[model samples]
Target chain A: MRFYAVAVYGFLYLPIAIIALFSFSAGRSASSMDGFSTGWYVRALSNPFVMEALWTSLKVAFFSAVLATVSGTMAALALTGMKGRLRAIFDVLVMIAVMIPGVVIGIAALIALATAFSAINPWLEVVLGRQLSMGLGTLIGLHGMFTMSLVVLLVRGRLETFDRAQIEASNDLGASPLGTFLQVTLPQIAPAILAGFLLAFTFSFDDFIMAFFVAGSETTLPIYIFSSIRRGVTPEINAIGTMVMVASLTLLIIAQILLRTGTLRAKG
Target chain B: MAITQARARALLLTPAGLWYAALLLFPLAVVLIFSFGERNPIGGYAPGFTLEQYANLPARFAAFRNTLTLAPLGTVAALLIAYPLAYYLAIKVSVRWKTTLLILVIVPFWTSILIRSYAWIYLLGGNGIPALLEAFGLGELRLINTPFAVLVGIVYGYLPLMVFPIYVALEKLDKSLLEAASDLGAPPWRSFLQITLPMSMPGVMTGSMLVFILLTGEFLIPAILGGGKVFFVGNALVDLFLQSRNWAFGSAVAVALIVIMLIVVALYTRAVRRFGVRRDDVGLM
Candidate 1:
């Protein structure tokens, strides 16, 4: 059992270790390990394109995470008050979104966006204006769409264990629906909200496919890394990848810590 | 307390409901509509309705075949490896080390799978692992740009996803059940097969479903590690949408993929539920 455990761990970590090691290797060839230096990191930081892509990725992730969290929290709250078939329907819909391939969603959005355009009917044009082709806005919108389902699933689990009585008490005290939600509900589910936020951010940050379709000329880090790899391996890519790995891992660890501290209580 | 709260709940739900409807449902409806429509000769969609694209689905049969074949094989390989590790983490590890070990399992998940797969490209490339193998008189061996390379990358990329769910399921399992099995004179392996494995079925089902579904649509590992030689439906979709700019055909493919996924998910859910029901019935008997 221990052997198996160690072997699995090795499988998981070895690739990452190799990536990290190669990031610092002085050699340009991905296959050759020619010794280590921090030169790649320096080059990665100094390169204007890499910096721009990094900034773009962070900006996209921030907006996507925020929007996803808000919508996901709303969905979760609605789910808690739902019962029977409605709840079942919502559950299935959320799962379907989760299970649907990113490639399918990306292409569907592109098709839908393109179709909405060029058809000049007033309603069609209005919808097209909203979709308005794939760009940074569309990329963020798609990221939020793909990630909101997971947020709903996670936050809903938190809300399931939430004490309804507290909301009732707040309501009985003459708090408005919005006020009770602001003062009572938000505090209770904040950890799930944070978890949802971080998870969505990580997902959006690492996302490539949907971003690839919608980003137009804007380069998110993953898309940049992807194109770089396609053009053949580079030490600069390793540097960028290493940075992304460190940042994402740090955020994930923090999220796990928050979750384990009982900050986000799982109601179910 | 009840009726007014229900009304408040409905009010709160309005924003999210409208958002989902407008963004998610509406786009999906558009795709469904376009899938049934004719493709304009140049590009995009034509007003006239037809299922010509669906009829042309056989054009990408190779993509579908590759996906179907690889997805299950990847799932099984991941499961075969994940189960024992999960078992060890859940049953054998001391409380002091379990948290650390579990964290280790998840640590890789923090990195982008794209970067991770890229690393595999190099290691399995000409100068990395194969070179090392050749040093020991194994001779020159090509590991990269093959189905086996893709499998290795897939298993590596998805192992944490497979492990965590199963680990959570096993961790939540009651230890006393294993003790009871042992007291009944079942050997360790027998106890595992009879008690442990049966009880962990939920996790197994969930993890396998998660990995299987994702693997079916995977593009990155195949594109990178398989050197674009291993065509998948996902790669086809990417090409149709991004490279070819064929929205109409892409929509058709997307709809087809969704239909296939829905069927698989339905069958899987039914099978799992039946297994659960039968297990419960046996317990009652």
Candidate 2:
């Protein structure tokens, strides 16, 4: 059993380890090691296309995280007071958002947006003298709405065990509702909110499946890498992959810590 | 001026409600509508409604067949491998290392699955494991671009999703029940079968459903690892929309996939409910 456990861990990490190791390979091919050098990493960083995609990814991830955090926090707070079937319907909707395959989401969103664009573009051309298309805004909207479920789940879970005494005490002390919310409720849920935001960012940044369909000539990092990979993975691709992995893993670790600390703080 | 609870709720839920209505519900409705529409001569959708797309479902029967066969195979394979690892982590590992181990299991998942799948291409490619085998005088063997390679990718990619839920379930198990069983002359394996297995069924079911559903729509793994040979509904959808520009047919495929997913989810919910476990206990993350 112990050996099996170790083997599973090895199986999990081996490919990742290979990617990281080969990122520094002096060789051109991804398949073989040709001694160690940081050339690929250097080249990958300096590459114009890689940098643009990375910047685009950073922008998309940041905006989407903010959007998801705010909307999901609000939804979580709102649903806490509700009871019965209405809440159930919303809960199922959230679950379905998470449950539906990314491909299905991508296709559905693509077709729907295309339809909407066709209907709305003629008016936009006459009125605003511009056209609507799938791009960063669409990416942000899709990622934000999809990841809102994560934020809702985390915040709602936190809300369920939240110490209501703090709010009640503040109210009894003649504090205004908004004042009480800012001073009491916000502080209590801040960690969860941060964690949710970080997770949303990580997911958006790492996402390719949904972005693939809707990116519409605007390349995010994963989309860029996917195109590069289709041309066959080189050592440079490995370097870019390594850099992305490091960035996302850091975000994920921070989010995990925040979630744990939030739980502990709630318990205390 | 204090607002009513109803007003506050409305204020809070409005953004999310509108977002879902427009993006989630509306898009899904479009998909349903398109599924019944006809493909234009140049591809994409046409105005006239027809069941021709539905009638054309047999064109991708092989994709559906491969997915149905391999998805369960991958899920069960993942479950089998994940169970022991989750057990070891929950029951055997010391508290000091458990968190580290758990986090390690999740670290790979933070990276783009595309990158991870790319790594497998190197490992399973001819110059990889096969070359090593040839060096050992075991003759040549081909691993890459096969169903086996795709299965390995699925199992490897989804292990953490399978592990964490089962780990949570096992960790939350009342050890006293196992202890009580052991004290009453039941062996460890027997106790596991009678007590732990039933207790962890929810986790097993949750993990299986998650992986199975994802596998049903999985294209990237098969595209990269299966080399486009082991077609899936997801790949078919991708080709239809992006490559062929057949939006109407793609919508039909998407609709069919959704129906299959809904059926699986409904069955899973029924099974979980029959076991008398609260849905909340099945933590996704």
Candidate 3:
């Protein structure tokens, strides 16, 4: 068992170790490890397209995270107060949203967005003097839609354990609903909110399929990585991939720490 | 006063309900509507209704065939590889080492799969693993762009997903039960088969479902590792929608995929519940 476990760890890290090792290689072919150099990293960073995609990913994740948090927090609260059949339907809907293949979602969104734009094309042309279609906004909306469930699950789990008396006390002192939520509920569940945002951001940043469909010509990081891989393998992509791996791992570590020690949970 | 209470509840639901409907339901409705329509000559859907798209399903039979077989095979492969590691961590590791090791398991999981798959591309490429094998007099072996490579990539990408759930189940198991089983004439292996494996059924089911479901939709591994020769439904759908721009046929495929996903998930839930092991908290992806 000990040997097997060590072997499993080796398997997990083997490719990662290789990629990191090769990213510093002076050679272009990833299979060959030549003299070490930082040329690939410089090339990856200097590439304007890589920078653009990175910026787009960050912007999309930030916006989607905020939207998902707000909507999900509200939904979680509403779900708690819901009764019987309505709550069951909402529950199933959320499950379906997550369970359905992302490709299905992507196609549906693509078709839907195209149809929507066609219907509004005349109006759009009248207003903006051109037809509009899917872009970063659509990507953000899709990410927010799919990731809302994670927020609901996290925030609702926290809310279930939350003390009701504190909220009642705020209400007992004649606080408005907004006031009561802000003063009593929000602060207590802030950690769950933070965790949800982080999860949403992670999903958004790492997303590829849905982004691939809706992102139009404005490439996001995953799409860019994918297209580059398709066009031809490059050592510079390995460098970029290494940097992305490091960044996401760092975010996840921060998320684990936040969720583990804070009100939200790392484990289910 | 009663109206006010109802109104407050309605207000709270408005944003989420709207978001769900516009994003999920509306798109779903559009796809369903398009599934019955015809594909236009210029690409995308036309207004005419027909069952031709459903009948045309067999056109991508190879993709569906590959998906059905590989998804389960990949799940089993992941399960076989992950079980022992999860067992070691949960049952054998010291408390101090457990945290660091588990974190290591997850850090890679959170990294972009694109990066991970890219790594595999090079490893399985000409001068990578094959070269190593050549050094050992194994002859020049072809690993890249094969089903073997796809399976390896699948197992590698999903190992952590399979591990964590099993680890959680094993971690929470009653050691006293195992000890009691062992206190009797039964050996450690027997005790494990009876107590540990049966008790960890939820994790196994959850992990298998999560991996299997995702694997069914996967295109990236096949695209990168299989070199576009090996295809799944996801790859087919990507081509139908993006390349062909065949919206009606794409919608039909999309609807079929959803139905298949729903049926499989439902069947899995029923099977799990039929066994009286309903552990829904598999830490949903």
Candidate 4:
């Protein structure tokens, strides 16, 4: 069993390790194992397009994470105080959103946006005084939509394990509902909310399919990577990928550490 | 206080409910409508209600066939690889190493699957693994751009997703049941087969279903590893939307894929339920 576990872990990490190693390799070919240098990373960092895409990805991820966390927390709170079939229905709906493929969601959002805009026949367009189309705004909207379900899942799971007696006691002691929620509930579930935020951010950052549809003319990092790969593989992409991997892993580790500490403190 | 709180709760729900209705439910409604509409000659959706796109579904039969075949194969492959690792982490490994091992399992997930799949592309290419094989005088092996390559990529990409669920289930399992089975004279393997396996079926089902459902719409792996020859319905949808700009046709395919997924998920839940596990046991996120 230990052998199997070790082997599986190796299978999971070996390729990524190789990619990280080769990003610094003097040679570009995967077959070659030359001396390490940070030349590729330097080149990747200096490239204007790579920098632009990175900024765009960060911007999208930040806003999308904030939006998703807010909506998801609210939805979880609403669901928690509900009962019976309505709760079940909402649960199923959220799950369905999570389960649907990114490609389908992307296409559906594009189609819906286009159809609704065109259907207004320039009347509402005149009223609004602008043409609405895909771009950064659409990308953020699509990413938020894609990520909201995941946030709900994570926060809802946390809510399920919550102790309700504390809230009852706080209310009984003459604290108002809002005050009790703010002083008690929010702090208790802060780790879960942060987990949801990190997960949603990572997801939106790495997202390709939905961004492919809604990005319009502006490109995110993943889209840029896709186009670059289509053109040809370069050592620069390996460098970019290495950076992305490091950033994502750092965020993930922080989130996990926070989760562990939160759980431990809760138990205490 | 109760009346005010109820009203406040309703008010709290309004934002998310409105968001879901506008962004999720409304878009899906539009897709359903477009799926029934005709494709305009120029490339977007046209509002003449017709089921011609559905009738022409045979155009993408190849894509559907590939998806249906590969999704299950990928799920089984992932399960076969993940189950033993999960068992080890849950039951055999000491507490000291479990967290480290589980973290290693999930490390790959932090990177984009696209980046991971790209690494597979290089490793399986002519100059990578094949060259290593050639050094041993195994003769030149063509491994890249094959269906097998695609399967390898799928298993590699999805293994963690499969492993974590099974690991959680096994970790939460009652150890006394296994001990009782052992004390009743069942060998370790038999105890695993009888006691451990049945109890973990819910996790197995959940993991497999999750993998299978995602694999059905997989495009990136096939695109990156299969070199664009082996196509799935997801790739077909991508082409229809991005390449062909056939919004109506894409909508039709999207609707079909959704329906098929619904059927598969429904069947899977039924099958898992029939295994006599509780609902919470079977569906772990």
Candidate achieving the largest DockQ:
2
List, residue by residue over B84-162, the lDDT tens digit for candidate 4. 9998889988999889878888889778988998888678988888989999999999988888898999999999999
Write model 3 residue lDDT over A1-268, tens digit each, in one string.
8888888889989988888888899987766778999999999999999999999999999999999999998888888757778689789888878887787888888898889989999998999899887888899899999999889988888888877877889988999978998888887778878888988998899988889889988899999999998887778888988888888777777777776765533232
Off by over 4 Å in 3: A127-130, A169-176, A264-268, B1-5, B277-285
Which is the better candidate, 1 or 2, if ranked by DockQ? 2
Q: Which residue pairs in model 3 clash with each other?
A: none
Sliding window of 10 residues with minimal summed lDDT for model 3 chain B = B276-285
Report the interface RMSD that candidate 3 achieves against the true structure, in angstroms.
1.3
Question: Per-candidate TM vs. native?
Answer: 0.93, 0.96, 0.94, 0.95
**How much is B11 displaced in model 3, in angstroms?**
2.2
Ranking by TM-score: 2, 4, 3, 1
Error of 1 at A140 (Å): 1.4
TM-score of chain B of 2: 0.93
Least well predicted 10-residue stretch by lDDT in candidate 2 chain B: B276-285
User: Candidate 4 at A105: error in angstroms?
Assistant: 0.4
For candidate 4 chain B, which ten residues in a row score worst on lDDT? Answer: B276-285
Better structure of 1 and 3 per lDDT:
3
TM-score of chain A of 4: 0.94
Evaluated with TM-score, which candidate comes out highest? 2
Higher lDDT: candidate 1 or 4?
Answer: 4
Q: Which of candidates 2 and 3 reaches a greater lDDT?
A: 2
lDDT of 1 by residue, B28-113 (tens): 88878877777667766776678788999998898899888888899999999998898899888999998899889878867898
